[model samples]
Structure formats: C-alpha cells, structure tokens
Target: MKEILPRQIESLMNILGTIPGIGAKTAERISFHIITSKDNMVQKLIDVLYDIKENIKICSECGMISDTDPCHICLSPERNREILCVVEKPTDVITIEKTGEYNGLYHVLWGVISPLEGIGPSDINISKLIERIRNLGIKEVFFALDPDSEGETTMAFIASKLRDIEGLNITTIARGIPLGGNIEYSDMYTLSRAIRFRTRLNDNL
Candidate 1:
C-alpha cells in the first residue's frame, strides 16, 4: 500500500478538528473511513453536505433551521400559538420535544448572552423575539435555558423585559438534584428544590 502524505491528511484533520468535540484522533479515524468508503456512499455524503450548505436557512419567524422561510413549527396550525418556549439552540428544541410535556412554539436564540464570550442581546436574536412576542400576541414565554450561571442571567434579563407586559406570563423550569444523582456528589437538592418551588426570589433565600 502506498503511504498517505502527511500534509494531505493533516489538512483534512485540521478542518474536521474544528468541529466541536472532534479532536485530531477522531478526525483521523473519520478521514480514513471516508477515504475507504464505497464511491456511492462518499458521493452521497458529499452531496448532502453541499445540499445543507445550499438549502438550509434560519426560519424568519422563529430562528429555527428550515428549508423554508417560516419553518414547519411556525406555520403549523396544531401548535399553540399563544405559548412560546425560548431555548439557547435548535438541539434544545429537540430535547424538550422528546419530553412530550410542551405543546407550544419555539424561538431558538442560537446562543446565550455571555459577556466573557463578547455575546450580547444583539449577538443573538432577542430583538426579533421581542417583536414576535408583541406581533404574534404570545401570552406566555417559557425560559428553558440550561441550568447554569449564564442561563440564569439570561432568564433574568428576559423576565425583566417582559415583567410589565400585560396578559403575558413568564416562567422557567423546576429544578432539583438531577433524577439519578447521588446525594454525596449532589450540590444540594433541598436548595435546588427551594429555588424551584420558591414563591419569589426572597422566599428562596
């Protein structure tokens, strides 16, 4: 077998490594797999990648990825139009949907506001969210952000903005030590539950 050139493999590995969670070793494995795959399979993969680049676009109304402007969720009549769930990414939308607990629409922010990362309201789609709330007459907004410091800060900012909006309700998920957590490693379920079930911020403290 002829030896593969270091520069050739290295160039491909570098680009693949740029993807989140894909390191050099994994990239090399994937590159080898792709190069050794059948011609049809490799051609199909290449075609799909190019098609996604050419066709995928953000939904104008909800910021979800879609081939069309509004996306299926925004256009679906079965969805509850009055309720809106705000999530940090499109993947979060899938996670929540899997729970089968929510029947509302979604607004994917694409990311959270993080000062350390130089991200702000403008960096995401908060302005478009505000417009959607007002124009679509959304009655309730659920903040389904991750359970982290930045998520908390983002929720606070959004709540403050919607506080005075009449006929609109803002809510967040309940918190507890996770379902399968050991008390030893757990931060504090009592504290977490206290925060989750608290009637107000002061009550929790």
Candidate 2:
C-alpha cells in the first residue's frame, strides 16, 4: 500500500474521531482500511449512509426510528393496545421486543432524568407520553427503565404524575441480582425482575 500523506490521514482521523468511543488511533485505523478497501464496498457504504439520512424518521407515537411516521409496530394490529410499555430509548424497545414475552404498545422516553447533567423531564418526550395516556385510554403502563439511579428517579417522577389518573395500573419490571451468578455483573433483566417482585416500598416494622 502506498504511504498515506499526513494531512489527508489527519483530516480523515478528525472526522471519525468525532464519533463516540472512537479515538484518534482507532479512527486512523478505520480510515486506512476504508481508503485501501475495494471501491464497490466503499460506495455501498456511502449509499447506505445517504439512504438512512434521507429516509429514516422517528415514529410519531413511540419515538422509535423508522422510515414511516407510525412505524410497523405501532400500525400492527397484533399488538395489545391496552398495555403500554415505557422504555428509556428506542433501542431498549427493540431489545424488549426480542424477548417476545410482551405484546403491547410502547412509549420511548428518549432519555432519563439526570439533574446532574441538566437533563430534566422536559428534555424528553414526557408531555407526549402524558397525552398518549389520556387520549388512548391505555389500561396499564409497564415501566421498563434501566436498573440505575437515573432510571429509578425517572420512574418515581412518572409514577407520581400518573397517580391521579383513574383506572391505570402502573408496574415496573421485576428485579434480581442477575443470571451470571456473581453479584457484581448482573444484567438489566435480572435487576428489573428483582424490582418487579419487590415487596411494598413502604415496609414499616
């Protein structure tokens, strides 16, 4: 392979380095690979990137990425409209759907409440969620947030807001240590199930 000029390589590295988790070294490696690879593969990648940028959009109701406004899941009649699952991100919605245990609609919050980061309820799609609850006549809301501090704080805030609404059953996923055995590296599923199965929050003895 011919030697890559410093200025050209540096320009490519700067662009790729802007992506999260990609540092200068990794960016240079990727840039070199892309430049040295076959022209057809690179063109295909370019085409796909343009296609995604031009066609993709967020689902109007759930905030999931889709080419359509309502998205396939939202339009599907097979889903249970009475039950709505609340998730932190669109990717989380996809993950839960892969489990195949749930057959309900979803509401993606887009993010959680993190006061330390200056991200509050208003920053996310909370108002749209409230409107959905009131207009759609949903029967139950399942909170499927992450098993972290921000997740808990967001859940509590949402629960309090929904308390006054009548005939709504709000529930969180169950929680446990995790499947891996070590108490340290528990996945979200185990932790979620543990919380779901938690005893009364106010256990006074």
The Cα local distance difference test for each model comes to 0.73, 0.76
Q: What TM-score does candidate 1 get on C-alpha atoms?
A: 0.82
Query: What TM-score would every model get versus the actual structure?
Result: 0.82, 0.81
Candidate 1 C-alpha error for residue 46, in Å: 1.4
TM-score of the candidate numbered 2? Answer: 0.81
Clash count (model 1, backbone only) = 0
